[model samples]
Target: MTIREAFTDLINQRGWYVKLEIPEGTANSTKKRFLEGKPVTEDKMKEILQRAGYRIKQVELWEK
Candidate 1:
């Protein structure tokens, strides 16, 4: 699944919260970017997911 999809699922299914560990406004902005089809860096995604207790297994790239 896409990182955005995964993150949304975590929020819906796991009840992930915006705790102090993640800088204020980061989660909201990240989610907004994902919804708006903006580019989200891998490092940022990794940091957010890792903080939420998830690890990325693999990443795939494609040319459209």
Candidate 2:
């Protein structure tokens, strides 16, 4: 399965949050490359996930 599918399964079936942790000193640069100044929307996320062979077709909102 793709990384996106696996991650979705983690939260949906396992009821967990997928948090990525970076090395202590690399956090700042990593944020600038990924998190900083980047829009956190479905499209943007899908683009990032696509690099790992993830093609998001649909999204379901949960009350959890």
User: Which number leads on lDDT?
Assistant: 1
> On residues 1-64, what C-alpha lDDT tens digit does candidate 1 reach at each position?
7777766676554335555255446766766686687988767776777787787788677798
Local error of candidate 2 at residue 33 (angstroms): 12
Model 1 error, position 26 (Å): 2.6
- Worst 10-residue lDDT window for candidate 2 reads 13-22
- In candidate 2, which residue ranges exceed 4 Å CA deviation? 1-39, 57-64
What is each predicted model's overall lDDT from 0 to 1? Answer: 0.67, 0.43
Query: How do the residues 1-64 of candidate 2 rate in per-residue lDDT, one tens digit apiece?
Result: 5444443443343212223332434434433444344534555445435543546565655795
Residue pairs clashing, model 2: none
Q: Best TM-score goes to which candidate? A: 1
Candidate 2 matches the true fold with a TM-score of 0.28
Q: What local lDDT score does residue 52 receive in model 1, on the 0 to 100 scale?
A: 76
Clash total of candidate 2: 0
